[model samples]
Target: MGILSDFFVATPEEALRYANRIEEPDEGDEIEELLDPVQYKRFTDLEITTLWAILEGSDWDVDRHALEYIEIGEDNEAWLNRFPDELTTLLARLEPESQAAVLEAWAGTEELACDPAELQPVVDDLQRLASEAAASEKSVYLWGCL
Candidate 1:
């Protein structure tokens, strides 16, 4: 499933567009470069959702740490909090193949938002999806919300 197979091509554009394309290395690009536990606390449902989609199941996770996004809260416990309720169950109803796809997608999302606690659920979800995909006669690849 080459979902992002074509997503990384650097295209040439007009002078204006090209100028906008010029990217100097920003601090954000290197997630590890930032101070640990964050210097400021900032998060929103939409932002978390977006980060989840981009980071999980990619090379980013192999090299990065999930704790980078976590800010040590007053409780001193770190888990991914504040995600929308709808997202928690979004993968529940899908077929295993779809679930597998969703899990893959979710992992990509998890690359950034994934916490140590959340990893178990993700593994469970993927296992369910794999079993479903295997039992049926087809291998399915789900992407995004059904």
Candidate 2:
């Protein structure tokens, strides 16, 4: 069955959105532009750091091709689409907790630095270890989380 057939979202707009994925060929470029010079330098340096982190401890031998996904320029759908033994290798090397921690660290260092606003919480009951200072203010709350 197709996605729309299985899902119960009310509008075509919603269904189409669920079917779509965010394309970020120039996502890094945008990030770089929005950041100040020092921030941009930090961002680039972090990219190098993420590159090495994904490289050195990874389970598989990810080639120059797969590394493009982590990079900021050019469409990388071709390499990203097909199933790779490389992904299996990468996942096999790390536990789910480790994976989440690594992602959290990277996102916190780079993505979080760009937006001082705050991160939308993963779960309300999941317990964030931060003060609720801004949680009372008007801001975005992603509703799709379980």
Candidate 3:
């Protein structure tokens, strides 16, 4: 399976704590328990950098605003990273049509290579998540399990 990724909103401290705890294999159940109350959107297989480029209307560049590492599992197969506040802000400001355009662009990326129609719900969830995060003055983070 490809990476299982969740984009969620949380305060910096809470995110750090969650990130740290999520790296522990034994804490999987506890982590699931904690996730019950969190605000999140699942976007499997979409890398954070690719999402950022879609929002910024730019080409994919891994080096562009490198994701801030929160934690990495000992096996190096699982990790957490934060999206920049600027990206969050940009995503929040996009209108529905703009959001659709971004989704179209993202679908066109070689890595995604899928029809934009298939991503409508993903874009909708992202727009809502970004808006909520911005309103609450929280950050968006990626928790990825490879």
Candidate 4:
């Protein structure tokens, strides 16, 4: 089994509940975890690389620094919050082709065992979450467990 990541648009209050694993019967809140880690990695790598490419358009290589800005979970588990500003900024700079290229690169590489087609929905879901977070002035978080 590989890692699993949960991506969500959580309000400040909602974030607290998920982080603490606090359960409220009436709240009916459901956190959406991606289907699998292999698929999730596509979103993770592509999002980071695309952001970097937009910021540093010259000679950007995904393999050279894919994990540079990406934070890893220290204890088989970790959470990273992309604040509204961060989400908005990156969202503004991303291009459609850049995202497609990232997906293509992942498919072509031997490093990951994933079908390129499977990653598209994950990408769409992430964008939806990011959009919701930005509109609501909330944060987007990637929670992972191995």
Candidate 5:
């Protein structure tokens, strides 16, 4: 089976709680479910890494080549706390043309196998979540499971 990736908007406390719980899954723990909360289309690690690069304006294949996935609160506590703001800032700073270019590149790339039209909505949803999280003073937690 492949990996499924998703994020959620929650208070910093809630984000950390979910992160801590999900990092070490337990028999009674439903934390992973809480972190994701809802079902979503699974994206491969390659596709997710490409998305990360596009958002950060780095090389799509190289920047996150070493990353397995964006774990929530593990050793990345600082990032977990700040991602909402960082994503919002990055999203706001990217020029529209640049955004389109990134999407187009990912769509045409054979490795990612992303369809531009189909992928656009997912991108938009991420932006919306980031924006809402920032506006509400909540943190956005990124999580993935295989």
Candidate 6:
């Protein structure tokens, strides 16, 4: 199986504290308890490079703004990364139509073609998460497992 990813909003300290905890198989209950009302979305197989491209409308440059690795599993099968504030701001600022357009473009690029219609919920969740993160002065963190 490919990577299963969850995008969530949390402060740096909170994210690091719960980074490894999220990999547990408790269906995120522990995380919810720890973060209390955590805002997140399960978006599998969505790579940071893809998000960078979609948000910046250009090739991803690691030097410019990369996903900052906060923690890594001992076996190297999982990790937590923090999203750059700029990308979060960019996503938070996208209009509804622009979000839909991004989803349509993403569908076109995926190996297994997805219906943009089906991705509306994902778009909405991410938009809401980004906005909430921005408003609260927190960052978006990705928890990925393989």
How high is the CA lDDT of each candidate model? Answer: 0.30, 0.27, 0.68, 0.50, 0.57, 0.68
Better of 1 and 4 by TM-score: 4
Candidate 4 lDDT by residue in tens digits, 1-146:
55555666665555545544423433333432321211254244345445444434444565643432334324335444443354445554456777776566545545444676866576566666666666776666655445
lDDT of 1 by residue, 24-107 (tens): 345324422321112112232333354344334333232232212223234322222222223223323344454445444544
Candidate 3: misplaced stretches above 4 Å?
20-46
Name the TM-score of candidate 2: 0.24
Model 5 CA deviation exceeding 4 Å by range: 19-39, 44-49, 60-84, 92-99, 109-111
For model 2 the local lDDT of residue 58 reads: 47
lDDT of 5 by residue, 10-92 (tens): 76656656646645567216655554533345654455456666677677655434332334534532223234365555553
How many residue pairs collide in each prediction? Answer: 9, 0, 0, 0, 0, 0
Candidate 6 residues 28-138, lDDT tens each?
566657565333333433445576577678865556756777755585776777777877888788887677778877666654267878666666766777898999999
Query: Residue 43 of model 2: what lDDT?
Result: 23
Q: What's the CA RMSD of model 4 in angstroms?
A: 6.1
lDDT of 4 at 90: 57
lDDT of 1: 0.30
**Candidate 4 lowest-lDDT run of ten:** 30-39
Q: What tens digits encode model 2's per-residue C-alpha lDDT throughout 51-144?
A: 2354345432234323212121343321111112332234234443454555554455543343322222211111121112123221111111
Off by over 4 Å in 6: 22-30, 34-46, 62-65
Residue 41 Cα positional deviation in candidate 3, in Å, after optimal superposition: 11
**Residue pairs in collision within model 4:** none
List runs of model 1 lying over 4 Å from the truth.
1-83, 106-146
Quote the lDDT for 96 in model 1.
46
TM-scores vs. true structure, each candidate: 0.25, 0.24, 0.77, 0.56, 0.58, 0.77
